[model samples]
Structure formats: structure tokens, C-alpha cells
Target: MQFLPVVQRIVADRWPWPRSFPRSLSMVRSLVLGVMSLFGSVAVAADWPGFRGTGDSVATGQYPTKWTATEGIAWTVNLPGYGQSAPVIWGGTVYVTAVDGAQREKGFVLALDAKTGKEQWRHALEPTQKAKWSETVSRAAPTPCADADGVYCFFEGGNLLALTHAGKVRWERSLVRDYGEFQGGHGVGSSPAQTADTLFILIDDRGPSYLLAVEKQTGKTRWKTDREARGGWSSPVVATRNGKPEIIASSAGTIIGYAADSGKPLWKLDNVVGNTIPSASVSGDRILFGGGTSRSKDAPPMGAKGNGCLRLIDADGKPGYESVWSAKLGISNYATPLAYQQVAYFVNQVGIVTAHDLQSGQELFAERIDGPCWASMIGAGDYVYFFGKDGTTSVLKAGKEFEQIASNPLWAAKSKPKSAGNESRPGAGSEYGAGETVYGVAAADGAFFVRTGTRLFRIGQ
Candidate 1:
């Protein structure tokens, strides 16, 4: 272990010096304390219950700044099926959901041994309604939400269910059976947010768009608020505004915040760049919003397009929230923007990253990364982790300037580089769909978890 040498050095270097008996005893006391602390450090790491950890997107512990494919991996387990949903950690197990069959017909949930990467349990789910999604994305794109008692998973086919920590199905429901069909361009990609008593969901579709809060214990709808019937992939985030929690959902024309408990409309910031693909991140009363997609072939080049501005929105309560600052120079494309310390980060689909001041939205630095990232960035201590679509993990030093700490890949040794060789397809990048895809990442206690298309890996545990 990395700490073993440091413990030995501290206990041996200056302990048995030429000293008096009382001084020696004091040194012994310090040595005992040091060893005890070292033992405490060996305890099991923490848990990341949902997307962006606490549904707030703030990673709070010291994580490793450097690692490699073989060097720093604590464990790696192959997933049963392929899904883009990120892995959520709770209790001593990690939970993930994926779609099966060549048609992506089946959806399943898997629980893995957090320490050993062993399959503890697997539940092949029976969909309440058949799912239909575009070939561009998987059927199971929404990430799962995990808590102490159970984990809730949502599939693009309109299935939402709660299962106990031991993999027993507690409650299940189909959104399509209850609320007609999801009329969206990309099926369902929004992951639900879990609160103390409710499971909040953002259903943006062509038929009837609504935000609903479901009782966690029973599969009962608490409240449903209708929205402008439009489709988007952004996940709803629960943020406390003026000491009360509100759920914020971003779409093409509007970004609205609703009362979390009552599902009442609170505020709306309209005429955004639109075509929002990234989830909103909250910092205290300030919420960070980022770039949108034009979705038109005749549209301007993807650089901002009067759209790429990384907007720092401040909650103003009654009169509605105001855009405090907007960094248009460099902004997001697909990956969600991250606010680390006082700096806000945006990673676009083409691998470009920009860091900005949280308050002023002043550009700190603009740099290209190994990305084309779909997974949102997460920061721990002085290092921020970026998961690129090419299975590249670019570790950047968290600061005002650009400093790359290390870069690594998640592909196996025998895997060859696949080319997303066809550019004629819609939204296809030169490198898109050609190689391994890293969909999302999570961090807890001290370990970092990465979810690729077919695998889940725990590093620096």
C-alpha cells in the first residue's frame, strides 16, 4: 500500500533520537496516535448514491490525481449488458443497469461486490412496456439512484422500479402504461433524482412533458406538473434555493425550477441557447448552466454559436433567477459543466475544456483535452477527472491554469482501436462510436468509479 512506507518513515525517522526519557515517551505517544490514524484510513471507502454523487455534483474527498490502466485499478468487472447509465455505489455494493439482446430488448440490474468486483446478484428485468429508442443511444441511458434501503432504476422503455439492497423487487411501474407514450427524439435519458421522501423525474417528450415526484416507499405519484411538450436529455437537479429545495430542469427554450416537495412552479429562465444535453449543477444558491445544440445542418459551427456560453445563473427567488455571468468563449457540448472550488469547468463534445471563475465567469484558461466527453467531469481536491468518449481518462490539475496531470485509457490490452469511420450518419464525429465509450463517473470516500459501455472499474480504493 502507498501509505505503508510513509507510516514506517514517520515512526522510524526521528523517534529514537538522543533524548530524555520524558521526551522519548512523548514521541512514543505521537507514534501511537499516528499508527491509530493509519488504521482508521484503511476502513472501507464511502458511497456515491446517484449521478454526481449527492445529486449536487460536488465530489468531496481526497482522490488520487494519477493512475494507469494496470497500476491503480482496485478492481474491474465486466457488465452483463451494455448501457450508458453510470454506476451508483451504496452500502458495500455497486449497482448498474444495462440493456440486453441485439435489439436491446431486455434491461437488467446488477449488484457487484465493491471490494472484490464479484457479481453479488443480477436481476433480469421484465419490462412493463416495450421500449423503442433511436439507434444512436442505448435503451438504458438513465442512471440509477441508490440509497441505504434500496435502489431505483429507470429504463428508456418506461420502466421505473425500486428494489431492496438485497436485489428484491419492492415496487415497479411503467410510465407509458400510466401516461401514454414518451414522444422524444432520443427516448429517455434523464436520470431521476432521489430526495429524503421523493423520487423526482424530468419527462421531456413530444406528447406530454411533465415533472413528477413519486413516493419512495410506495410506487405512488406524489405530484405532477406539466411543462411545454418538448424533448431534451438533461437530468433534473434538486437545489436548495432560499433555504427550500427546488428541482431544476433545462430544455430547448427554458430552464425552470420547481418546488421539490409540492411540485409547484417557482421560477423560469427562458430563451436559453436551447437543445440542452447537460445536467445542471448547483452551488449553494447559485446554479451553473451550460451550452446547447442547434440541431440544424445549416446551423453555425458548434463553437458557441451564440449558444456555447457557460452561464452562471443565480437564484433571485420571486423576480426569477438572473444570469449572473456568461462565459461564451468556451462552453459545454454534451458533458455537464462542473464547479470545483471557485472555478467552473466545461468540456465540449470535441475534447475542448475551459475553466472559468465561478463568480465573474472570467475565462481562466481554454485547452483541448483527450475528450469528446459524454461523462460529466468530477473534481476531488486539486485534481478534476474527465472521462472522454474514446475511453480516455484525462486528469487535469484543478486550478486557474491548464496543467494535465496524467492520461489513461480503459480499453483492455487485446482491444484494437475501432473507428467510428462513418461521418455520414447524423451527429457522428470522426472518432465517435469508433472506440470504447466512457459514459459516466462517480467518486466516494477515496475511490473513483468509472462506467464504460461494457464494464465498471474502481480505482484508488
Candidate 2:
């Protein structure tokens, strides 16, 4: 389809028509042009449109299982600046975001040719709010989501904008300017979630925390629901419950569902202790919530929180949800709880993966992989890929049993790029200095786009 315009132009101007061209043939040409215009670049099934893509559930189509630093690599491209956001794919273009300078003064949105990893266009995003950049703080961590209309990006510095496929800015909004300055120690990591017409953003900070729904086309606030001041970085998930869609947020010890259209509170599940970082995952009528032990000393044990499936029930003329099954063995710390193939998988911060039966919540096996994973595990077909924080990925067979497949490292060694050295350093043995960490990833069109802090890699057959 790269030459689609050329084909259209030729048909319009240079069609080999005789002086007495048949009117029937002219009608045929007009119909062909109309069909092309009708299909004009909508998001197909192959597009990974948003965060954890459709609740981080199992992905269709086979992705690459094994790859080395030098082999099976389609192309590796250096980004303009360091970014923690995952690379999102929409057709032939891959969109990613990054922040530049010591104070994160400038942000970058880049569109790359998906096949060759060539730079298609780069748009420098000027931040509305300024903050001193540091390794401990988030740097473009909120993964941008894509749709057929455009790619929408949100930065921790309070800038959100929509860009077309050809690098045209549709609209931009400053959340801090519209709302207020964020007062969280660490910056925002919650990515944007969207339905057909609205985009949902979770802003959970110590100062002003709220759930906002924006009109996708105009970047205007549709509805805003303010909440108690709580510091959390969990992203919101849009799920259909009781035949209508609801925006679900499991953070700061509560799992609350809000009506997507009206921003009215639907139902709330309390006592989800230490549930801050990982977003909720959806599986049919069941929603899987995960939490780890918080750094606060008084926080309850991780198991005390919502670490299981909840069945949305509509009984006695009331709509509510109840926990169907709870995890007893391990709880998710950074990664969201994964439920695939009737098996539930939980990964702790130290890279230990625990499997449980999706129905009974019985622990199947507990095994360690090459982890300390920050990026969530993506299940493709019969294999689940665990992206480690420090450039290694462990692939495992997806089933009730723990079966190791392959350990793929994105880089042979931890090499610091010039861009990474500019950031201020934290204390020794801190997680801050790991420049090669895999922040997030996206899989689509038979390729896996792995996002490290400073680069993006495409892995394919």
C-alpha cells in the first residue's frame, strides 16, 4: 500500500483511455477509487493499540520466540532521547516517545518505518510543566497508545497530544495547566486507555488525584472524577461489565469502576492493600487484580489485597463484583497478573514466576527466570515472553506446568550510551543506573517491538 497514492493518481490522470472510452469502464474506475477511500487507513486487527494491549491478554499470531543480540534482529534504532514508553505500532509505522535535556525540558514523538526502523518523522514536544530529570523519576514512562485516527502520547511532565500518521499534530493538552501541578514523589507512569471515542487517563498523585475521560478528537475533557489524594502509578483498564463498558482502576487499596460515558461511580472494591503499580487485566467477565507489599511499613501483607479474579454480578437488581478466586502463593509486584490458557501467572520483583489454576487459584509451580522484570509478560500463542528489566527476556511454554523455552537478551553487555550518562545518578546498588532495562514492549504484524530506556528493537523471523 506504499504506492497507493501513485496508483490513485495514475488512475485519475493517466488511465489509458481512448477518445471513445466506455462509460462502463469509467464507472468501474470510479468504484475502485471509492473503495480505496472507504477503507482509508483504519486500525486493523494486527495493531497493538494501547497499553498492555487489550488487558495484556494472550495475543493472536505467532511472535518470534528466539533471538540473539546479533541474530533474528530485524532492526535496532537509537531514539532521539531516552524513553520508558513502549513502542506502539499502527500499520507500517511505529510510534514512541522520549524526553530530552537535564530538566526534561523537551519531549520527542517519533514515527519510524516499522519494516526498516528508519525515522519517518520526529516531533519535538515542548513540556508545559518543567521538572528536574533524574533516573529515580519517570522519563516518558507513560506508554503512548495508537488508533486509526492517530497516536496519542502523554508525558509525565503534563503534556498530552495527538498526532496523525504523517506527523501532524491534531491537538494538544496540558493536564497540569488545565488541572494543577502534580505532587507525587515519582512522576506519572499511567498510560492512556481509550474506547472508540474517549481516552481515559489515571492521575493518582499525592496532591490532586483523579480519573479523567477526554474526547478523543478535540482533546477536551468529557468528564473528570476527582478522588482522594493517593500516590500511585497504576494505569486504568477499560472493560465491559454487565453488558456496558466501565473504566476500572485498582490502586491505593481500592478497585473502583466508573461508568465510561458519565464518569459516575459504578462499584467499588475496598481493601486492595499495596495495589499501586500494576494495572488490572481483563478476561471475559473476570477481572484480575494484582498488588505487592508497599514500602510503607504499616501496609498489609501482599496477599491481603486484591490478587485474584472478580466476577461482575448483577443480582437482586444491584450491580456488584465479588472475588471468584484469590492467589495464595505469590502476588504480582510490578507486572500485572496474567491469565492465559486457563492458567494464571504471577511474577514477583525478583523474577520468580508462579503459576496457578485460573479457576481454583491453586498454585501450580513456582520457578525463577532471568528477571527482575519491569515490562509485563506478553503471551503469544503457546509461549509467554517475560521481558527482564536488564535486557534479557525469558520465554516459557504456556500451560499449567513450568517449562523453560529460551532466554533471549537484547544486548550482550550493559553499555552506556552518551544520552544515558547525562542523567543524575542515585545511590550505589540503586535501580536507577540500569540504562538497558526493558521498560515495555508491543507485538504486532509478526514482530516484537522491545523498548529499552534508550533504544527500540524489532525482533522478527
Candidate 3:
């Protein structure tokens, strides 16, 4: 029955979602625009493949807005335990995930070498339900989904594997051994939503929530649904409308859509409020979604008309979706609200970066960067990266006015890098004891990986 306070980072901005799910921008103009840049250009390797990359976290090349902590980095790697998950690439390899015991009962996946981060294979996993490691629980927090047929990962104790880009496993599932025990204490941060053979997965916990799909070549299940216990941690996107594919799902009070091929439902929009931790973003046919500040002041309005935009309307012919614009201020708390190109960024949680106008939500420019962003802001070519949790990243200018351009930093408070100790629990780690923060961000070939819960860096140029 706990509807808030899951990880409670001091409170303030409470919502900001954008699990985008916008697929083909023609694969970002055929593998990232004028191809790579930051110092020597011509590297060309694009493939971020999941949790926001390509689904509209936007990436079209030209990374590195000025580095620090060792000059534009290029390779860092250290992880073996802590993970807030997010580091997936495909085509030169680079998958990630972690969670060591203290009761997390181990889980890993690794597989680096995207041009020399090395490692190459790890696998591990085995947590049918151990749950005890903390920092408010959710260690390996969901963010895997590669393609060219492989990498799936999902841990939060329920496990869900799938390896194979040479790491070899190809199938594994546990969801607490076939669905049960996930009653919320903030475990599962939901992340897995493919299409090219299904894979969805949502699970809003409190007990009994659901939204599966599976079958990406034998993991088998294909359809589930259930939902309505609602605790919220958002993640499940994949849009398309009018030509088929669906599955959006903005948590908490509701924003459903399902039917990515038989999971059915279709459309819904109910009450909604402070949107359970950011997760809904797409651009072209719009979609966007936002929410924050709701510890229940009777809970209903989340400001600026509850931050909005949704459009997938066919009406008389059935298939629907329509809110069509609302942000005159924008709201979001755990990062995840960026539309790019047509502009629409919101940052809230103490860094206030609003910029709306992705087709008429007006309010262009709120300003205040240098922090706040639990990883969810990356729009390549012509910049738009915010990354800061405690490592600074800023660089904005996707245009509509709020130009920041560069803030960079990533390590240098005495070199940062400490949270990796668990050796049978002696002192464990994390709770912010040195992991420094910066939870996740990714970019392809030309580099910019940045994930910290014990390091992952890459940056570039």
C-alpha cells in the first residue's frame, strides 16, 4: 500500500516521463546523420537499441560537448556489482547489467568491447527472489534490449534473461518463479519493449500487476494484461498507430494502449496524476506525457494541465488516442521527457529545464541546469544532452531558445569511483557512498556511454 517514497531522494520534482518509443527516423537518417564528430569523425557505428535510444531519446551523431575527468574519456569500465541499468548497443557489442549478493543473490550480463572496453562475456544471473541489497532496492534496474536477435535482461529479483550476442543463454525467466511476490518496496524499474517478435513486459507492482508479452524466439508467453494493482515505476513504450503496433503505458493513474499484436486493450486514459516516475516519449505522431508533484494534495493536477501531448487518432474507424498538447510549463522528476527537433524538453527535480513547443505547447524556456536528470536526455546532432545527477553534463541547444551548449564534468571531485564493494556484505555499497550518481545514458560507435553505479564511462573525442 505504499504509493510513494520508494527511493525518496529528498523530494521535490515528482514526475517526467518519456520512454519515447519512436523507432525509425530512418534509423536516424541511416545510421546517424553526417556521421560522427567530436574530433576526427568517420567512425559511424550506430545502435543504441533500447530504453530510449531510437525510441526517441534521439541520437544522430556528433557527441562530446567537452569532457573533463581525463579529457573526453574514451574507456572506463569497472562494474561487477552496482547497476541502475542502461548500456546496450549492438554491432560491436556492449551490453550491461549487474547486482551482487548481500541478498541480491547475483545477476550479471556484461559483454563489452565496443571498440576496446574489452571484457566480452559474463552471463551470471540466478535471483529467483533473494531481494535484500538496498539503496532503497532495485539494484540492476531494468534496461536491456538489444537486437539482431539477442540481449534482453530484466532483473529486480524476477530475473528474465536472453543473452546470445555470443554470451549465449537465449532464454530465461523467473518473474519470481512464474508471477508472484513483487508487492512493491521499489524493486523492478520496468524496461523491455521490443517488436520484431514481441517482448513487452510492464509489471506495475503492489502485487498482481501485469503486462507481459514475450516470445522473441522461444521465451514464449506472448500475451498477459492484468494491471490495476498499481504502485508504479513506468517503462513500456513501442508506438506506431494507424499502421499497427501499440503498447504504450504511462503508469499510476493510467494511460494504457496495448495490442502490439494481441495483448489487445487498445486505448485508455483515466484520471492520471503525478505519473509514477517518468516514462512516455515519442515524436512524429507526438505522444509525449508528463507528471510530477503528487503526494496526494487530494492528488489530481500535476500543473500546466498535467503536462501533455498524445495523438494517434482514427476515431470512427476505431483506434484512438488524443490529448493533443498541454505543457505551458512541463513537469517531470526522474528524467524522461524530451522530444527533440520539434523541441520539448522538461527537467524538473531541481534543475528546472523546461522548453516546450513540440507542436504548440508553447512555453519555450525555463532554464537552470548543472544538475538533476536521472539519465534521460540525449538528442544528438545539434545537441541536447542533460545527464547530471551529480556529474554534470548539461549541453543543450536542440533549439526553441534555451541554449546551454556545454557544462560537462563527469568525475573530478578527487576522481570519483567508489561504490563497488560487497565481498559478502562487509560494508556493501551505494546509498550514494561514492557511486556519484549519473545513472545511465548511451550513444553508439562514436561513443558516449556514461553509466555510473561503479562506473562505465566512454564519452568520446
- Candidate 2: where are CA atoms >4 Å away? 1-45, 299-303, 415-434
- Measured against the true structure, the TM-scores of the candidates, in listed sequence, are 0.81, 0.86, 0.34
Candidate 2 similarity to native, TM-score:
0.86
Give the per-residue Cα lDDT of candidate 2 at 205: 81
The candidate that achieves the highest lDDT relative to the unseen native structure: 2
Q: lDDT for model 2, on a 0 to 1 scale? A: 0.75
Q: How would you encode candidate 2's per-residue C-alpha lDDT over 297-363 as one tens digit per residue?
A: 6856544665777866777777678788887766787777787877788888778998988767788
Sorted on TM-score, highest at the top, how do the candidates line up? 2, 1, 3
| CA RMSD of each candidate after superposition | 13.2, 13.1, 20.5
- Candidate 1, overall lDDT? 0.68
Question: Which residue runs does candidate 1 get wrong by more than 4 Å?
Answer: 1-45, 131-134, 296-319, 412-434
What is each predicted model's overall lDDT from 0 to 1? 0.68, 0.75, 0.72
